[model samples]
Target: MLSAVYKSLKKIDTYLFIEQRDDFSKVPEPLLAMFGTAELVTVLNLSTKDRLGIADINKVRAELAEKGFYLQIPPPPENLLKEHLAKLKEQGKLSEKYNK
Candidate 1:
């Protein structure tokens, strides 16, 4: 299935995937309000049989077919936070040795 992706400016890490780019008009008003002004991310050939990077292709297709759009919210920021903490710990250790 051909899908068009939209990214929300107000909501970080949030997106909307639709079957057609022109179908944006079909999206509900309340949803558009929550999503804010969306920017086009990309148009991709998505298939259920093919593996997607972040979203399940089948689920996205089903939602797009039934509802006018599919919401694609990004995963938690835990990995970035963990990496930052690890870097901070390393810096702290280096500072302690240097100070000593």
Candidate 2:
């Protein structure tokens, strides 16, 4: 089965897959808001080998057939400690703004 792949404009590596282009409306409102506007990545035949980076082809197909959309969350950053430190640094700066 073929699938429509979309990338989230606001979030990195987040994707939404649907069976047809017209089926985008079937995606839930909360999901749409979280994903923001999705840019079309490609139309792919799911049976093809390695069509997806992380998600299982069978699970993707099952979700689409049952739920009309499949949400693909990004894998965690490779450097977990570094990401945590960066987030803490950012939050520290934001907190300073309020303290001033």
Please report, in order, the local distance difference test score of every candidate based on alpha carbons. 0.82, 0.83
What is the C-alpha lDDT profile of model 1 across 1-100, one tens digit per residue? 8888889999998989988985787788999999998899998887634866688877888888798689988887678855766687777853454443
Q: Model 2: per-residue lDDT, tens digit, 2-77?
A: 8889999999989999989747788888889989988999988877756468998778989988988899997776
Model 2 TM-score?
0.71
Which candidate has the highest lDDT of all?
A: 2
Which residue window of length 10 is worst by lDDT in model 1?
91-100
Over 4 Å off, model 2: 78-100
With candidate 2 superimposed using the best TM-score fit, by how many Å does residue 44's alpha carbon deviate from the native?
0.8
Candidate 2, residue 91: how far the Cα is off, in Å = 33
**Structure candidate 1, residue pairs in collision:** none
Q: What is the TM-score of each candidate against the true structure?
A: 0.68, 0.71
Off by over 4 Å in 1: 77-100
